[model samples]
Target: MQSVAKIRLADALVKIMEKEGIKYIFGHPGEQILPVYQALRKSSIKHVLMRHEQSAAHAADGYARASLQPSVCIASGGPGALNMTMGVATAYKDSVPLLIITGDVSSNLKGENVFQNIDVNAVFKPITLQSHLIDDPDQGIEIIKKTFQSLKTGKTGPIHLNIPRDILQKEINPSLLDESVEINIKTHWKDINQVKRLLRKSEKPLLLVGAGVLWSHAAGDVKSFAEQHQIPVATTYPARGVIRENHPLSLGLLGTRGTQRANYAGKNSDLILAIGCRLSERTQKGLGNAPIIQVNLDKTVLKGNINIQADVKEFMEKISPTSTKNTEKWLHELQSYNKVHKIRTNYDKTPLKPQMAIKEILDGIGSSILVNDAGSHTTWITLLMEVSEPSSLIFSGGFGPMGYGIPAAIGVSLARPDKNVVVVVGDGGFQMTSQEMATICELGLPIMICLINNQSLGIIRQWQELYYGGAFQVKLENPDFVKLATAYHLKAKMVDSPSEVLAAVENGLKLNKPLLIEIKVDKNEDIPLPK
Candidate 1:
């Protein structure tokens, strides 16, 4: 008979993380999570100490999006856990897979209203796919395995695990750590002949992809399928780089912030094939009343004329190419919209135009992974920047969270040390999580922080200007960002002229360390909306 060795629950959990190949845990330490931290100290996993609990979650979210693997974030109970709600919600909305662990009060203190004790699981239930409370010591390892299983299967998103502090110190069988769970994801395919018949009959067709393509690693397959069928492809914001925006058949982004050509294509297409994306209101804004073929792993989002619930990659591989009519003329007509509605990027103004500044920065950064925050600048970049590589551009698209760029850049930098990371943030969003500069400097990450300083909440101000009578609380009296970056021990520069914008960006990227370039732009500048 083999004897089972005893192991601490926290230690076993750390071992499970190791078994699952988690490299880092982005979090802020607290008393409740001390045991896991202690176990982590002796383990192979590196703990990235974030300045705030929310930033930790954002960092983990960024890491998962960039690496296409499940990432981990840890926080203490109550306030610590509550602060991560926005980040958790952001990940949930975007379908990013993350393992979120929160340390809770002792099991005996339930309902006693102990310090830092709120039902973490209940609070996170709505935001997470699965929120679990590990009350039984015997179920600790099993719960963790289940969490990983949940992260890998179905429509992947963040999963929450609340472990009581006492349970962390409890003993468990070491043999349980060696146990493994195999996830057999069943693939469901629809009738290929019916889909091909739709393709054959349609003269003007558009392929709209979303984040699911990236999550399923179906970029190559999607690109090949589009080319094989001579179809124009447009992607949602999160799925920007899936098909390489520079391709001739690419219609770029499709939505409110999307290109005019892409929107026109969507509004006039005879048939629409939407894959791996929810046709949200924003994505469906300028779309036409075409018969839609929607493919997604989640059956809930399968609301289309013809719905197929299957893995994106498997579906793409199985669907054989068929002949289409008038695609060449359709492609040419769609491409003509680009010339008719071109956004000018050249502006030689005193305080730089946002479009010009954004163009300069994006042009200067060569093949670097771009992570952007929510602002009017997001519109400018989405319009001007071109993405050639899949999963290279990361955005908080669905949740549209402010203060996401800096911390997300940290995660991206950690995940891909060989590639430089650039964070394009507005003055308003930068201030929300500016404290993360210390983390950047401490880690010596190669990140170029492009701060578009319009000195106001640009997007909100635009909305107020358009809808409301005028701007009210949208203006800002900002600090000297150059001095702020310097104080954080990062290389800093300020550029107000259009000619110096590209130079500043080039110099910052060459520094090969944490650098911030503050580009002053016209506060009154507005994002050009599709007419």
Candidate 2:
């Protein structure tokens, strides 16, 4: 740890981050951050330059998700900070670790009509773990350290920091620097006995995994607990693949656009171990009847939609001893469901059985990161894919924003080059951030792109067909994603029939480079899910 003497605030900022082990900074620089930028240039931290401030935030979010660490993004005042909000909110909703560092107007000019100024703290408060502004030069290190410490404590999310232009450039006076507190404080889970009791008494238990498991790198623990007790795992959109989808214990996603298996598992379960996730309506289908054994870091989140409560890690650590294991009676039932589903899939003749396609991929890939963009594709992909490891599946669950998956996957790839990044995106959704193909190509990140090309905004079209008499305007023929990939100089392939699923899965991941496999599924196909 660098000793903080009364020094330049930017100097203190760099030293504090270095001590916190922050190696990479993602953002675009502006006049407000010039002092910090100059200091950063002299530091070992590598800054990734992005085309847009929002992209920078997404990149930072990606770094955090992929690396499983608090990733940082720096932006200028006003517009830069606002743009950064997109990714900040994404991190907030997804429960990803991110530090959003924004340059603010000078303290004196903050409430005045200064150029490029913003109320960064006020704007980012809701989306952050903590919102702080660096006012005095001497308070820099303590503030930085405290911010990171606060973020790591409970239900960690995005943390925002506003560094004023003038203060960052100011010299700190000696005797004011103090680093007395530890920054790695984490809380204990709530209702340990209650959660364990629920798990123990559950006749049919459902283990719901979210991005928090990934954030905590607790997939191994979750998998062990689920498998040991034969509990079925249901994934949130952002938490797909945390349990290997085909794992007898894994039931894929539940809710409005989920699989029959997932829906049944959740609905029928007597106990729902909603670990590290706030059971949202999209995952719960408005039925919060099952007793939810909620174990999370934040006690405040205990007031969930269901009767769930507590910090998961704390509960598990204390309750694992009290909890009995070696129960596999229910595994037989899950296996029976899997077999029946498979046999029925072979017999069914739908235009495109999304479940079948998903089953194929889940069966084929043992370990890979799956990113699902918003719209109908998000639901379809969730219904199909399974992740055995935490952080393997990524999504914009809260925003449900279209065109978020592809770029996020790109970010994930940058963060986890060792792991394979596979994006399951629809034609319309893919069109939103398809420009990321160039980023993938330039970065040389190997990711498999499963472009479900139905030639329409399938989700809205599904709604329109159901309610609007099939009047389609914006949901018409889509531009060729294959051509788009080709234009980006990335590998491209087309799959028109079910016969192509296996081969595409094989070659797409085999390319060992970025590739787009466009699957033109039947438009009439439906994702059987909870209402």
Candidate 3:
């Protein structure tokens, strides 16, 4: 009888990951995960060692956003797994597809209260779409297979898998990992005829695109459809670049912090064709009682006058409106409104205005990917920056985590080495994951860190000033960021005036190396919201 080929469970797991086309795994190493780490040494998959497990998850999240492919992150048991909760939750909230793996104690030690033993699945179950533990080495391959299959189907989000330490060393049949599962996704097409009828009857119809459009890789189709039928386009914050913001029909972002014209269009349109948008409270606040036709793969988010549970790209492709009502008058009115209510960024003040700083950064970056952390800086960028391509502008929109810029930029840089990456972060958010500077330097990525130092949690301070009558506990005594960046062997500079803003950014980008430019702006400067 012919003997079947045997392989270590850890080796088989790594081989499975390789077969799944996972190029990188962002993570930190631990004693419990050493066997898998050993297996990775022989595989073609590159492991990026993040400064913290949270950063690893965040990095993987950014990679998925940039690459438009499922990304992976790993952590050890107990504390390591716990640290990944926030990042994983952020991915979940944004619907980014990420596969998170964690190493746990041996199966025999379960229920004995051993060292570094905690219920990882329980901790992660609420945050991830699926959380499973692989106790049986023989079933490990099947579990991983199901995990990847789940990640690729339905509404994309994070999935967690915990493998016991002892199980990693056991032997398994290597042949079991060879065959790939054929996932047949059943695409739904229910309300297309109604949607087409609505479009034909409506005069001032608007297309409200969201992150779902980008995730489905339907931006081109969405844009083409908008152009084919004379419809204007507006995107949610995370979907800023779905259609080039400079397009005449593009209404930019649509929400409280969005462009005035977009908000106005959302409120005034006769019919709204919302594609892949969750229509969150912020987005819905601007959109008036205009009847909406929402199309999304996740039926749970389908709350509209007419809801269709279908893939956004597929829907866009199939719903071909043969003829539509001429909207030239409405388009002209929107164009006029866009000109009159343009967000201004031409402040040449002594201490830089955040708006002006954002404008300069956008101009200096010039088509590179711009990733912003959660803070008042996010508001500034959303207001002034215009992205020209899908996935070029990234944000922690849903969970709104601080300290996501640097690590996420690391992931974007690694995912697209051909394009330079810029991080626009506030001083408060920068301190949260600044240690990743070492990782950037080690990798020698050409990422520019634009630290907007307002010396406080700018957004919270703004809230307090507007709503609570004062700022308290929001102020921060910041460190010398220039010296700190220098300590990490990054090219560093400080600019406090508008005259120096563009020059500094241009200089940093010209260097084509890891750089940090700390822009000292007015701490009391509030984000300019539409009146």
**lDDT (10s digit) by residue, model 2, range 1-531:** 987555788887887788789887877888788888998988999776666677777777777777778888899888888977777888888777788888888899988877886678899999887888888766666777777776565567888889888988888754444446666445543445566666667667777777677666677777777666566788776677677776766777667666666776776666777778776757768234777766666555654434434345544455555554434665556556553232234424546665566556656555887777776666545544545656777767787666677767767887787888888877787776787777778777898888777777766766777789984774556677778899998999887666567778876787789888887777766554344
Q: What residue pairs are clashing in model 1? A: none
Q: Which pairs in model 3 have colliding backbones?
A: none
For candidate 1, the TM-score is 0.95
lDDT of each: 0.88, 0.72, 0.88
Task: Report the C-alpha lDDT of model 3 over 7-81, residue by residue, as the tens digit.
Answer: 999999898899889999999999778889999999999999999999999999999999988999999998899
* Cα deviation of 78, candidate 2, in Å: 1.4
Candidate 1 weakest lDDT stretch, 10 residues: 183-192
In order of appearance, the predictions have TM-scores of 0.95, 0.83, 0.95
lDDT-better candidate, 2 vs 3: 3
Q: What is the lDDT of residue 455 in candidate 3?
A: 88
RMSD of 3: 1.9
- Candidate 3 ranges beyond 4 A from true positions: 180-187, 339-344, 347-349, 529-531
